[model samples]
Target: MTQKTMSSLQRVLTSLSHKEPDRVPFFLLTTMHGAKELGISIEQYFSQARNVVEGQLRMREKYRHDCYYSFFYAPIEVEAWGGEVLFYDDGPPNSGAPIIRNAENIKHLTPPKIEETPCLLKVLEATRLLKNEVGDDAPIIGVAMSPYSLPVMQMGFDNYIELMLDQPDLFAQLMKVNEAFCIAWSNAQLEAGATAICYFDPVSSTTITPREMYLKTGFNVARQTLAQIKGPTATHMASGRCLPIVEDLANTGTAIIGVSVLEDLAELKSACRGKLTVLGNLNGIEMRRWTLEQAESKVKDAIARAGSGGGFILSDNHGEIPWQVSDEILMAISEAVHKWGKYPLTWLEDHG
Candidate 1:
């Protein structure tokens, strides 16, 4: 039988379906890196829809990555909900202050309509442009912070942690509002042209929220939100100690789960095998600091660990690809994946 050659979309979708494509797909959690490559300040890159589209296009063209993710920062929804954001010329935006300081404020809070919010509207606009320009050539993912992180953004992380224990009922109510907002924002992006929603939930890890609390609030809300989305959905768990909740994350029914280098890729692959595509485990910080030889070694190691059978994507473990990562490093990662990541169980036996 003749094997099929897959486009970027087909390759990603194929892997998401827990099957192999011609080669392993590459995903970058890019933000500032794209702006840097475009020779523009991060502020300029995210200031308008056109700049966002151009930056993403240039980055995708340069990397020729299998997936292009449209993400500005984690605080888009928070900014929409009246939180302040500190924009930097050289880096991605950062959340400035908490909008909801106490649990009592939760009752008065309301979800922002995506169309009425400036930053979110820009994101949707960029998604539309990318879809029109790229057509069906590659998969364009629209990103939003998951319910776990949303509450953290609204109230500061420290306050949120306290609420999880002191005011569980209030936290649960806030999560419901955040979940509704995430669903609306994600659906708008999907309607605008994103093929999938990559929901980022870094605060749900055992390191921050207790496993039991997360399962009750974060996990439940994530499952509900994923169910409402029409297209494929991916959950990006950015915390280091994410191993404990791997099964809970998979239970949310996301088509893909973004694993960080902090977790054991082999263990995650074992847990998620034939269930959902696992996309990651590369340390973005280490990748940025390593030489070409070092980077290639790590890339090959990741492939050897998780790039078996099908259902694995080569990617950076963190949320945003750091600006320190040069184009050479990024390209080296792609080259190494193409060279070492091939289907079938023969290579593992040879190396092992």
Candidate 2:
């Protein structure tokens, strides 16, 4: 085999530019795995920027993955709005209570300043450390929850759904506040040297909301929020099906879209062929039980389906590596990508 040539950042950028690079880049999205590497609990690992950065560096060194996940638990963003975060031994953190209770509260809320938020500051610091140490070699991915989706934590999901349907104006008000925070926070990461922001907008998916509802609320809010961010971006709807709105997703000025396992990878690749890079489809929940051979087969299949061109990043459907996934399985997936994801995938053209 030929010696690999591109840095992970260059590899990813080349793919994003819609051309084959040396190989397909992979982002394992190993949030908790980093904590596991340090022999510490996820909660303690997240408490310090140095610990998070050290763990991320170690993970990349061991796995040969392409990205630095300069991210914290999902609810840290909610913490900025005064929500309490309760961490777990097996997964990401969750909110203790909904910060916004009444519809009227939405109208009066002010977006929190970065300096005023402790956990968010730690995340940014971790990003800065990654940039200083390894930004030249790999892409540092930052995440910003979409204004339309932050309500899943700002208030409870059921409450958000009721408000979204019953009081559209109040929903719009909440979006305005979230929009400001999302833009500011995302731009801050870019300023700190993140390659792109992952615009995580799960509730906007067709599985969760109707087409008309998204176009009216989530779509418009995402467009506005994504437009104002300072750097490149990827719009991800977590594990929700995106095929119905694939074109709509492509139109959001994002360079990539994270697709669900529910969508056919080939169809998704065809749908956004020239317009966007495609990332993910492996089922994180099911992956915990995957054998080495099964993991390799999944990688080969994903590459056969979507790796023909230059716009693919191998990853999980939900944008996170579940803690239950064994280290051996993750290593197998990485090794498989390196085996089958080389550019000008002649094997696929011949056999697929």
Candidate 3:
């Protein structure tokens, strides 16, 4: 079918399957910004399942993008595990004090039951709401932090790193707990109607740990968690540090591997050729700062760099697009992708 004739869900699935859809699918990282367009506060945006559905639907209608993700603050899982989380009126909630204060604290921890936690329950509710409203019109992505990232959420980031190096055995035990929670949480989202589960692992990047350390700690846990997820899965690590382990990450069997703006898309496309679908490279920070012309130029550049065949999704390299980026800029990005990211990119090369 032509790009105009295909539904968003169809376009995303086709691209994930390494086939050319009518066009390259556009996937937004956050729906919180959509709240502002709908004339609601960030607090209200995250408070109700219906509000999130409304905000995301508004953005999809306005931008005509191919995918909608149900992402709230990253700390909900942490909060469910008894960690403190600080909320904000205009931004995502922040991780507060570490729950796993020391080695002994791990003994007291228990895997959170999804149904018992209001914070996590809301996300599941939002997924169901979106599925009911959008049906097959668009792909609804469920979001979760990576196993390594989850520990950093419950324990402070610096503390978790220290634990990794200072107390290896203790850290492994903690990872087991995190891994179990990730599996259960991911499965629940899949059952709730998310077409795919996207895991963010900013901590496992080489910037945070060596390849050997990551393989022992983060990589294995991720593989175990992902193996249990019943639907298509994607992973995002927000640094070039992940480059060294690209092949390893792909081997974990996730269908999509996210590429940050810091990494060269050309390199990723080459490395992930047949193994993983590549999603990202647009710098959300730059998108927020650039004018319409500049933003469109960047989108066109990303497509030229990574949109050669299929197995690509246009997206921001980071977790979420900043709330301050104007709707005009967001629309410009969607329009540019549709205009320049058509499949059979050979057509553009020959015509241009």
Candidate 4:
């Protein structure tokens, strides 16, 4: 079977349901490298609706990624609340300063209105364009940050973590406020045609002090925000330090769990134990240095091990598919999936 005979929506659901399809599905959170390689500046691409649509079309035609990401993040929403962002020429923007640095400042803080933000509106327009162009060709996904990431991006991570120590109540209150932002922004993207949303929180990993992550972050409020999204959701942490929190992450009720470089597919598969969909394991750092054929072989082997069950999807631990792989390498990955991914056991034999 070929893509001409199937729709992107069908492919997603089919994979989620644990059934073998003509080819494995592709999903991405966001890709800065893809944007840069395509020669579209972030400002120019994000400024107009057509630029956003064309960028996605080029990626779809080139890599055949099954899902299209809006390339927006939660901090952009904070910008609406009057926070400042430092934009870069080649990657996602960074926050300039914390909007609320002290527990005492919490009393004066007011959440930003989603409809009024400039950067956020750009994403809304992109979502609308995605719906119009590839509406049924591929599912579109939007992103939001978890409480751990939201506060730190709005207020410096160190400052916010200190507040957590001096006053636990303040930490809880801040998260409560941030949760509202998540709901509003996620709802807006859903309305604009997002079939799913991703909540990323790499800051609360095990590498940080427990007082900062586990107690001050991670578990409790994350549950609340994940519960509010109307569409399917995935919890993404692109850091190796967070592997210890896997069980706690499993409790979030999200549809998928996206792990990072620290964990391997075999480990993730064992940890998830069929409780959640596991979607990663290709090592971005290692592949960046390998030949295209070597990279494709690595991805294929990962699929054979981690993708054996119905719940796994293939992807790199972090970053976009590096341009070094070229069209030929990417096609090799697709071809391998088509050849070896089907179920009903094509080659296995019984010893009886």
**Model 1: residue 71 alpha-carbon error in angstroms:** 0.9
- Winner on lDDT between 2 and 3 is 2
Please give each candidate's TM-score.
0.95, 0.97, 0.95, 0.85
Q: How close is candidate 3 to the true structure, as a TM-score?
A: 0.95
Candidate 4 lDDT by residue in tens digits, 266-332: 7777777657777776666565466756755676667666665567777766534543444555566
Cα-based lDDT for every prediction: 0.81, 0.89, 0.81, 0.68
Cα RMSD, model 4: 3.6
Best by TM-score: 2
Query: What is residue 313's positional error in candidate 2, in angstroms?
Result: 1.1
Worst 10 residues of 3 by lDDT: 343-352
lDDT of 2 by residue, 1-352 (tens): 5646899989999888888889888998988888899999999998999999999999999899999998887888988888899989988888888998877898789999997788888988999999999958998999999888889998899999999889978887888888999999999999888889999989988889888878888888878888899899998879998888887887778889998998899999999888989999899999999999999999999989988778888889988889999999999999999888887687886764
Model 1 CA lDDT for position 223: 90
Error of 3 at 148 (Å): 1.5
Segments of candidate 4 deviating more than 4 angstroms: 1-5, 28-30, 33-38, 209-217, 240-243, 319-352
Q: What is the per-residue lDDT of model 1 for residues 1-352, given as tens digits with 9 covering 90 to 100?
A: 3356779888887777777777788886687776776677887778888877887888888777887677778777778998898987656688887899768999878899877788888888888998999999998888878877877778887888888789878877888888888888888889999998998887876766788878777788889999998888888877446677777877988877788777788998988898878888788877768898887888888888888778998888876787778889988887887777656535678788
Q: Taking the tens digit of each residue's C-alpha lDDT, what string does model 3 give over 27-99? A: 8776668678768777777889888888888888888888778887777787788777786766677889877
- Candidate of highest lDDT: 2
